[model samples]
Target chain A: MSHSFRVEATADRLPEANAGLDAWWSGAGLPDEARFAFELVLEEIFMNVVMHGSPPEGAPCMVDVILDRQGDGVVMEIADDGLPFDPLAMESPDTAAPMEDRRVGGLGVYLVREMMDTVHYRHSEGRNRLSVFKSIGST
Target chain B: MNVNIESTEGGVSVARAHGRLDFGASAEFQKALEGAVGAKPKALVIECSELEYVSSAGLRAFLVAARAAKAGGVGFAACALQPAVKEVFEVSGFSKIIDVQADLATALAALA
Candidate 1:
């Protein structure tokens, strides 16, 4: 079973897309830990597409989020059709930099990696899709 | 996310924070922190023990609070952040600008 939502690549719609996942989780009885993992990773993935996905103001893309219980673990896949960029390749934000010296962004992706059990990305069909999985017991 | 806050007779305000501190909640967090500092408290203590996660936006929110408190001649300090969150503060070098403490009691006194 899978549900899909198409959203414009914009920051304002980020939360809306997230809420869809929350609703799905609630109905499926997803645990708190797994829920958090999905929220974080999805935010990072979705926002990246919004921020850098298209022409900075191009057409919105479709996101297909599938929530299925795979042996007590939940699998979430995020697909975007704006641009071809993989978040896993992005450099880690420099924690050592002073406040004034630190880059303005990039911490979101790093934190996502820290909190998730597994993350994978692939660019095909001119779309970037990322899949994340976490065991329910991990929470 | 909920912020548990109370003001002491000494004019000090302390906030107990629980939940992930990220961009999603940064707006609300910034508002609450500013509201506390606006009361002209002598000091501010942020209990972050229960605070799960924080991003750079979270750090910016704290900076906004600190800057406001500084303008008011009061002080601000953050306490007991989770290791991962703490690492973020450390990575962004927020530890240097924002005074981080081991516990609420310690943060309260740090301003004294």
Candidate 2:
């Protein structure tokens, strides 16, 4: 089974992205933990596109999210026409660093990588595409 | 999202966060944190028993509040995290950097 949705790269559109996933996840019969994992990853990717990837000068911002159930796992594809930035390419912040020396932000990418089983990035035709995979019923 | 300051007793400021702390709630979360930190309480505790959901944006708010507490020489901690919220903290390694207690009493006592 598969589901897809498009979101304008606006903060307000987050609820739509979330609602769309909620409806499908309910029908997909995923556990609470698995659903939370997917929700976190989607929020991170969607917000990144809305806040950083999109141009500050008001360029058109759009993101396409596709979900597919494969065997015992689910795969999510996020594609955006914003900047050509690969979230995976960013350096991981030292999570163990003390509060005084810690840097804000960048935790989103780290969480996405940790929650998903496999994450791949591609930049094609002026678009950034990210594929995230996770096994169903697994935390 | 609704963040109500539950109490400020014995130099400990306790804030009860309710509802989803996702992207839409960041501003409200930050405002509440600011109010808590502004009091310069010796310690700050965010009770999350009523919090239903948390996303990266919510985590970011927590991080920012933590930083503010450190800068202001105030103690900060979180307690009563729902299981799913705890998982997010663990996965992001935030559990290592911040003080997360399993319940409200322990968190308040530790702050005291």
Candidate 3:
């Protein structure tokens, strides 16, 4: 009910987050599909923080992850303080086209939105908070 | 992840890969693929049954491999893809240009 946790948004912390989340997921008996979804969501969020959230050169963006177990899935709340941007408001890339024809960026976030069951975004108090939820199969 | 290399029948070289193929694997996968293609292997099989993840960087490495194979005129393909890994291929449109099959038998038959 109160599985609150926060992590800094840094490439180095990616492995730690993945391991910690994997442990939490396995402990909760989430299915492999859900695990993949969670990882994909995490990657998209992390990349956004790294590539777009920070300043042009780069800045440290703190990522706070609060995990809550839902009926049959887990809801993850992520907040970033780098920029005041809305992720859910972004349009998806054209997956219909070939790779060479497609744009280079935005595909990660687009794929994350497409895969996750629910994605919500909010900008409040100079922070971008993203809510992501995905249902997992029984392990 | 584990990678193994061996020679197929008629002296064709085949390299098999297991587990996730991602940025973490770029170096290993690139080296192996390059070596195999450099040796003039008739075909290369990237068995993706255990591969779980692939980022843009990983896809870039695969693209490099594809380019190399195409340049060298050596057959290259992947087989036994898990659904997740296969989805990455689909999202990137790699399934169209690269050789992809549902099973090893099909891949070998095609590549052979």
Evaluate candidate 2 and give its CAPRI docking class based on DockQ.
Answer: medium
Residue-level lDDT tens digits of model 2 in B1-112? 8988856558788899999899899888987898799889999999999998888778879988988898899999999999989988888778988899989899988988
Q: Each prediction's TM-score against the native?
A: 0.72, 0.92, 0.82
Docking verdict class for candidate 1: acceptable
- lDDT, candidate 1, at A129: 84
Question: Which structure among the candidates has the greatest lDDT?
Answer: 2
A17-87 in candidate 3: lDDT tens per residue?
66767877777666767577677677668767765677666567777777778767788887888877777
- What are the runs in model 2 whose C-alpha is more than 4 Å off? none
Local distance difference test scores for all models: 0.75, 0.87, 0.72
Winner by DockQ: 2
Model 3 CA lDDT for position A8: 73
Considering only N, C-alpha and C atoms within 3 Å, which residue pairs clash in candidate 3? none
The DockQ value obtained for model 3 is: 0.33
Please name the candidate that would achieve the greatest TM-score relative to the true structure.
2
Residue A120 in candidate 3, Cα distance off native in Å: 2.3
- The parts of candidate 1 lying over 4 Å away from their true place are A1-4, A98-100, B1-7, B15-24, B31-42, B47-56, B63-74, B79-103
| DockQ of predictions, in order shown | 0.31, 0.78, 0.33
Candidate 1 residues B1-112, lDDT tens each? 6787898766779998898776678889989999999888898888898888665567778878888887788888889987766776765567887889988778767777
Cα misplacement distance, residue A11 of candidate 2 (Å): 1.3
TM-score of chain A of 3: 0.85
